[model samples]
Target: MENNQDSRQRFAALVREHSHSMFRAARAILDCDADAEDAVGEAVLLAWQAFPNLKNQQAARCWLLKITVNCAYGQRRGQRRVVYMDDLSQAAGSAPSPEPSGLWDAVLRLPEDQRLAVMLYYYEDLPVAEIAKTLGVPQGTVKSRLSRGRERLKALLREEEAYGF
Candidate 1:
């Protein structure tokens, strides 16, 4: 019983530590804040259920994030809607900044696979191997996605500059 209690405590602490990352990963996949929150909650529950099966405690972060990404994908599949990015920003509880950066806008415009790879690798500061684990893709695939995402972002920025928006 004590062992189970210890495991539960450890899991809760880890969840707290990585909650923001989990939310960000979910938000990257889902269209709205409510969906993202739901995904994260579901992921946490799923992770708890499978926590005992997890072998490498050192890889907990990647493992939790992998669960989160999967949950977010599931949520997105269930709800198909056209939601504006501005609405998402507002729902996240932050007023629109006077100077909105186009880099993030371009990142959001990338293909889903590339966007997730970029967000996990760059924004989350996860190593390529860890990103591969989190994304369930091979390291080479993650590298390729990052490469393509960067190229796409460059083109998007250039277009934005040309249009003077």
Candidate 2:
């Protein structure tokens, strides 16, 4: 049996390693930095409570991300309304590019399921199996969503280019 200190240290190391991924997952769902931060905070607290019960240390990243995503969904549901005060580009803590990229815009326009799958697969660099486990979907479903999201992004980018926007 693991001692309490060892458990705590292991949990802390896992959280520290995956914190950025957790925030990105939350951000993907919530679309608001503050709300995403709140979701991540809530996920950490919840995960801490559940850590002792976790069976696989290797699966910790997916487990934490799944918690973050659920918390983000719950946060979205609790909000009566969503207000966008900052430009989406500014949310990443960087100055807007002189030529703003439409790729991210197209991604935002993707259907929620496709968007989540794409973000988890590409942005988070998660494998399809892990994404499926994180999102509680089948691997085939995640693959299909990624395929569709790519096609949609290609069409959207083509349209943007043709319009000279």
Q: Give me the candidate number with maximum lDDT.
A: 1
For every model shown, the clashing-pair count is 0, 0
Supply the TM-score for candidate 1.
0.79
What's model 1's overall lDDT?
A: 0.88
The numbered model that scores best in TM-score is 2
- Against the true structure, what is each candidate's TM-score? 0.79, 0.80
Sliding window of 10 residues with minimal summed lDDT for model 2? 96-105
CA lDDT of every candidate: 0.88, 0.86
> Lowest summed lDDT over 10 consecutive residues: which window, candidate 1?
96-105
Instruction: Estimate, for each residue in 31-147, the C-alpha lDDT of model 2 and write its tens digit.
Output: 767888999999999999999899988788889999998999898899886556556557868785543347766777778888889888887899999999888889999999999
